[model samples]
Target: MERISTCLKFYLLEAGNDGSIEHVDKALIANLMTLFFAGRDTSGALLTWFFWLISKNPVVENKIIDEIRQNLAENASPKHIFSNVQELGKLVYLHSALSEALRLFPTGPFLLRVPNQKDVLPSGHKVDQKTKIMLCSYAMGRNAEIWGEDCLEFKPERWLSDKGGIKHVASNNFLAFSSGPWTCPGKELAFIRMKAVAATMIHNFHVCILDGQNIVPSISAILTMEHGLKATISSRWV
Candidate 1:
C-alpha cells in the first residue's frame, strides 16, 4: 500500500490534480487496487515461466548468458548499475524470448468485459451495447490460423526482422499488457524488470529443472505456477 500510495503521489504531481479531480476518488482506489494485485503477480509468473523455459533449453540459456556477459563487459560496474538504456534497449534477443514466453503463457489468460456501446472488432465480431465478451489472449497467441502451425514452439527469433531489428510484434496477437484505454500502464516497467532478472539470474547461475516435477498453471485471473517451479542453480562461472 505504501508503494502504491508513493507511485500515486508521483502520478498526481505529474498530472497536477486540479479541482476537476473531485470525481476520481473511487476510480483512484480501483486503479490502485488493480496495480497492487496485477503488477507483482504478472511479473512473478513471467519470471517463473522464463526460468522454466531456459532450464529446458541449454542453447537458449547459453545465448541469454552470452548476451548478459557481453553487456557486462561493456559496463564499468555491471554489478552496481545498468550503464545505459541504449544497451538495455538493444537486447533484441531477450525481448524476443520474453515475447515468446508471454505468447505461450499470458498472465491474464482471458479478459472479460461488456461493451459500453455497439461495436465491431477487427476480427469481425459484432457486439451489441450490453453484450458480454471474453477475449482469449491465450488462445489467440497459439492459434495456427494467426501464427502458423509452429505457433506453440518457443521461438524468439520470430520477433526479429530480416534487418536484424526489433520487429513490430502485433499487439492484437499479444495482449498480455492488454490493448486500448484499459491497458496496463506499467507494461514497460514489467518487461524491463523481467528481462533484467532473467538476464542476471542466467548470467550468474545455470538453472536445472528437477526431474519429474509437474509444473502446471494455477487457476487464477493472474497466471501463477500451479506448483512452485523448483530448480537447482549452479554457478555459471564454475
Candidate 2:
C-alpha cells in the first residue's frame, strides 16, 4: 500500500505541475485494479494448467524433479530448495516445462486488437479500423504449421536448444505473454514467481492426477480447467 501510495503521490505531483488533478485518482485507481486482476488471474490460470499438464505426464514431472535435485546438489544448499533468483535460474527444464504449458494453454487464449488504419497482415488478411481482430493463440500454438507435428503433445524438450539452454521463439509465434510495445510488463516477474512455486512444489511433493478424471479447458475469457483439476499429492521426501 505504501508503494502504491507513493506512486499515486508522484503521479499527482506530476499532474499538479500540469495544473490539473481532474480524475487523476480515479484513473490511477482503475489502472491499479487492472494490473492487479491481470497479474493475479492470469498467473493463477497458468499455474492451474501447468500442474494439470505435469500430472498427466509423470516422465516430464520426473525430469523436472531430476533437474531440481541436480541444481540443489551442485549448489550444496542446506535448504534443498531454490533460495534466490540465481538458484531458480538454474532450473532450465522447469522453465521450459512451464513455457510449454503456457504455449498450449495461454492464460488469455485470444488477443483482441483494433487497428488504427487499414492494413494487410503478413498472412494477406485485410483489415480496417472497423474490424475486430481476434488472434487465437491457443489454436496457433497447436497448429502444425507453427509448432510442427507433435504440437499437441506436451513436450518440454522443444523449448530447449541444442546447447541445453532455453530456446527463443518469435513473440508472434508464442503469444502467451503478448507481443510488441504493449507486451506484458510483468512477464519476467511472472516467470520468476512461477518457477519458484513449481520448483518448490515439485521438489517437496509428488502430484498425481486422480485416475479417470476428465480434464478439459474451460469455456471462458481465460483458460481455466472446465472441471477443476483433481489430483493426489504425496510427499517426495518421505
Candidate 3:
C-alpha cells in the first residue's frame, strides 16, 4: 500500500470565495474536533458510503456525468461545469443520486429526542412527557411500506417528477435530515456543498473503487465505514 501522507494536514475546503474566517488554534482545533467522534469523522464515513455506492452503480454515475454535461451553458463545452452553488442547483440527477446515497447510508443514522409534553404519535402511539424517543433514520429510509418494493434499490428517478424536476418528498418519509419544525437548518447549504464537491469531482476525475475490498458500515453515533475505504482516482482528461 502507498501512503498519500505520513502526517495530518488541515484541508479547509471553502464553498465560496466571499472571504475566509480567521480562527485561532484553539478554535480551529475545536471545530475540527467537533467533526470527529468515537475515533471517526462523520463526513469521511458518509463520503465513504457514498463513493462505495456510486462505484457499484456505474449506470447511475454515467447518468450523473451526463446530466452535468446537459446542464452546462449552451455555449460551454461538456467539461465546462458549474462554478458556484447557485448554478449547481440545476444538476437535478446528481442531486437525486446524492439523496439516494443518503437514503441508504445516513451519516447520523440515529436521532434521539425527548418530548416536552405527553402526546400521541400519528401511528396512534402514546408518548409520556419527558420520555425519550429514538428515531432510527436508517431503518425508516429503507422501509418498504414507505418507499415501496424498490426502497432498497439505488434509483435516483424516485426523486424526480413526471416532467423531470425534483419531486418534493416529506422529511417524514425521508428522515435523512429529520422532520417537522426541528428539521436541520443547514439542509439547503449541505446539499449545495455536497453538490458542488461531487459535481466538480465527477466532472474532472474518474473515481473507481478498488476490487476485493470488503466495504461495510460501523456502529457509532455517526455511521462510518467499518474498514476505511480503499479506492483509486485518475484524471478523466487525457
**lDDT of candidates 1 onward, in order:** 0.75, 0.83, 0.75
Candidate 3: residue 24 Cα off by (Å): 19
Compared with the true structure, what per-residue lDDT tens digits does model 3 show for residues 1-238?
A: 0111111132233311334455444454554454333223544566667778888999998898888877767786646555676579789988888888888898889899889889999989899876799999899889999889899998888999999888999888888777897775446656766777788889888887889877777878788888878888998887
> So what's the TM-score on candidate 2?
0.82
Clashes of 3: 0
Model 1 stretches astray by more than 4 angstroms: 1-15, 19-37, 75-84, 120-126
Tens digits of per-residue lDDT for model 1, 121-203: 88898888778888898899899988889998888888889997778766766788788767666776676667767766765
Can you list the residue pairs that collide in candidate 3?
none
Instruction: Give the per-residue lDDT digits (tens) of candidate 2, residues 111-210.
Output: 9999999999998999999989998999999999999999999999999999999999999899987898767756766787789888888888777777
Error of 3 at 117 (Å): 1.0
Name the better of 1 and 2 by TM-score: 2
Off by over 4 Å in 2: 1-37, 73-83
Output the TM-score of candidate 3.
Answer: 0.78
Which candidate ranks first by TM-score, i.e. highest? 2
TM for every model, in the order presented, reads 0.80, 0.82, 0.78
For all predictions, the C-alpha RMSD in Å is 5.0, 4.7, 9.2
